[model samples]
Target chain A: MRVLCCVKRVPAPGAKINITADGQDVDTAHLGFAMSPHEECAVEEAVQLCERFDGEATVLTLGPPEAEEQLRYAASLGVQKAVLLSTDGSSWDPQRTASAIASAIETLEAADGPFDLILFGNESADSGGYQVGIRAAHALGRPIVNAIKGIEPDLDAGTATAKREIDGGFELYNLPMPAVMGVKEGLNLPRYPTMRGRLASKKIEVSVMQAEADEGGQTRVTLKQPAETVSNTVKLGNGPEAAPAIVDLFEELGLL
Target chain B: MADILVLAETEDGAVVPATLEALTAARQLDGDVHVLLCGDSVDADDAAERLGEYGASTVHVGESDLLNVFGPEAWGQALALAIEEISPDVVLASGTSKGNEVLAMAAARLDLPFVANCTELPSELADDDEVELTRVQWGGSLLEQSQLSAETRIVSIAHHALEAESAGGSAAATETIDMEIDDLYARTQVVGREMAEAGVTLATAPIVFGGGRAVGSAEAFAPLEECASLMGGRVGCSRAVTNNGWRPHRDQVGQTGTRIAPELYVASGISGAIQHWVGAMASKQILAINTDPEANMVVKADYFVEGDLHQVIPAVAEEIKKRKA
Candidate 1:
């Protein structure tokens, strides 16, 4: 089984997100970078699947050159190969991103074999378009589902069982090999990179390929912050003394 | 006027509240609101009546064996065919998990651009070839204004962004359509389900007792659990709690976790980071209990108590118990 995972490098936002002066991008001066939480789980799941199934897992990313850091991070987590679909630090529309990623997958498959399974984050943390995986699945002519939290591959049967979380339970889907999935966070707790793994990650070779695709129809005009509503909190009391006031308020609200 | 079509989501034979919200959004475009209902389990006549009250002028029902079970491709194919037959200027749906998935599938099939989780749409979108729209990003913490250029504009209204108001109109006329669902679409259909114990879940709970990193450890959540149970609610945790392994990720409340809308959310020891704040902002009322008087959660909450949750939660629970006795 050959597994492939796609990841995106996003700003590691703390407390609040600051916008650049041009309003075209997130201000990166004071922020760090990391993959979305969902993508981190996807990378972990891919590595785990390969480890169990006796195969290699390749990590691919469509991002700027700095995204090599993310690819190397995947490497530190036991991913066997790293490929960077280099961009020019501009955000690509979901459609264009999917197209470029599908092209890159095809190029990679031509050299090796087809990936038995491919994974994507449910949606990017920043844009949250929620369509790239679906579009890419369509382009690849493979069945796909989003918001998957659990996966079990039956190598002998050449099938995979996926679990999606709903309000009150789980929805299970079975897909044939060569399927794609848009996995969410909580699929697994990703492992931390060890010191030895960090040194190994630096030695891993990263294949850089240009992301060439036409712009999609949806174009960004600007980014704006929602107006914050400053709350006038009524301080009930302090410590245990506040407990009675809290209960009274709850009673007033009819929660009693 | 823009002719708008809304994809109605139904549950247990009735239209979901979010779909009504979508209908409300559609009416804002100053167009005749048409709806598409797909599912054999849905009571089309009853759903049409409810949707009509929300300003749906027509309800197009598509029922097929393929749609009897949830399949994104089959539903998307039905929606794509409906768009072709109806020739509406714009298509709309609630920004739900399934709603966005099916619409993205339909958009992919039609090779058109789709904008999901839109908070605002231009009134004159039908008259223009390209128009600017505002969409929710970062799970509602930020908004992105974008220009959408497409022959048929497709969008989904962000959940809870607008109120579901009744227009008090007559019932919509129902028309059944031939849903030509491909057998291949069944490959991706839901095969089975493992239902959780039915009760007050985190999403539907009226009261949510939320704990953050300050809760210390997993065992420390016992106080919160007892309080939530006493209040007939559920216990939720912040992303930090889950990340620290003090709680399961399913119990997390944040942009990456569950987006909860409760009558009251008691957030304890939470700093109210942007990611977490967006998810909790929908609560009707918030009471923050943190040691830091200037914590983000405390400042933004409707009520605050400057104290440790360890002492305050137990004290609150004891007060409720004594009152009950």
Candidate 2:
């Protein structure tokens, strides 16, 4: 099985996210970068699938040179190959990003055969457009599903079974091979890279290809931090003393 | 007035509350609201009647075997066809998983632009081809003022961004659309479903008791469970707790887990990282119990109690039981 997983580099924000003075980007001076949480799980899933099927797992990202860091991180997690769809480090709209990634996939598939499966984060941690994977799948003429938390690919049968999480339970879907899925975070518990794996990842040569696509109709005017939720926090009491007050407040809210 | 189309979703043969929220948002755009209700799971006639009361002037019902179950491509194709027939200036849907998926598919099929999780739209959106709007980023931690330059604007209203209220309008006229289902539409049809045991879910519970890593071990969640059970609520956890294997992912309250809107969220020992904050921000009230006074949850919550949850939670649970007696 040949699987490709798409990842994005986003700031790993802690308590709060601060914007740049221009409001065009996030302030990264004191921040660390990590792969989007869902895509990290996708990478883990692809690696496990390859391990089970004895195949290759490739990780790709569409971002600037710094995004190579994310691709290398994927390599450390057992991805055998890495590709960088190099961009100018500017944010692209969902349509443009999808178009560029689809084109990149086409170029890569031309060299090697088509990937049996392609996985993407259900949504990016930052922009959260919720469309890039679907649009890219449409462009590749592949069937796609979103919010998938489980996948079982049958190579001999050329089919893949996927499970999507709903409010109370899950819905299962079956798709032909060469399918796509927007995976959610709980697909798997991502494994941390071993010391040996990290050393090996440094030697994995990332293929950098310049991304080409026209800007889509959606444009970002600026970014603004949401107004902080103003709360006149009422301190009820300390320790066990707070319990009676909590019950009283619960009664006030009609929870009793 | 501009012609606006809303893709309505249904559950248990009635309109979903989020769709009504979308309709309320649509009314703000100053348009004649038309609804597209598709699927056998929904009673199209009943949905039309309810949607009409929400200011929907027309309801276009489409039914097909492929649409009997949730299939993204089928719904997307149906929406694309409906758009062609209605020729609306704007299209809206609830920012649900299915809602966003279908709209994305439709946008791809038609090669148009679509935006998701919009919290606000400019009042002059109907008149302008290129309009600026505010949408949530980082799961509502940040907001983006975006520009959409599309002939037919397609967007989804953020969940719970607007209250769902009826406009008390006239009954809507019904129109039926022929859903042309093809073999490809069934490629990803939902073939099986598994339901969780009936109880208050984290997303729907009136009160949620959330524990963090400070709860220590898996066994430490017992008091939280007891409190939730006594209060007729549900127990949730932060990502840290889930990552530590103290709870399941389904019980996690955070950006990647579940976004809840409980009336009261009792956050115990959770520090309220941006990821967890986004999920719990919609709660009507929050009571934070933590040892640190400067903890994010404590600072942001409506009420705070400074203490170790180990002692505080059991006491709270005991108090609830005493009150019941």
lDDT (tens digit, per residue) of candidate 2 on B1-325: 8999999876656788889899889998888889988866876667777899998999998867888777898889889999998989999999999899999999999999999999976776766788998998999999999999998899998988888999998678998887887768799888898788987788999999999989999999999999999999999999888777778888989899999999899999999999999999989999999999999899999999999998988998899998899
lDDT per residue for candidate 1 within B101-142, as digits (tens), equals 989999988989999999966786755769898998888878
Best by lDDT: 2
| TM-score (second chain) of model 1 | 0.96
Error of 2 at B123 (Å): 2.6
List, residue by residue over A151-256, the lDDT tens digit for candidate 1. Answer: 9999889999999998888999999889999999999888899888898899999999999888888999999999986899989889988999999988988888
What DockQ was computed for model 2?
Answer: 0.83
Off by over 4 Å in 2: none
lDDT of all predictions:
0.90, 0.91
Chain B only, TM-score of each candidate: 0.96, 0.97
> Tens digit of lDDT per residue, candidate 2, span A85-173?
99899989999999999999999999999999999999999999999999999999999999999899888899999999998999999
Question: Model 1, stretches more than 4 Å misplaced?
Answer: none
**What's the TM-score of each model vs. the native?**
0.98, 0.98
TM-score of chain A of each: 0.98, 0.98
lDDT for B58 (candidate 1): 94
Clashing pairs in 1: none
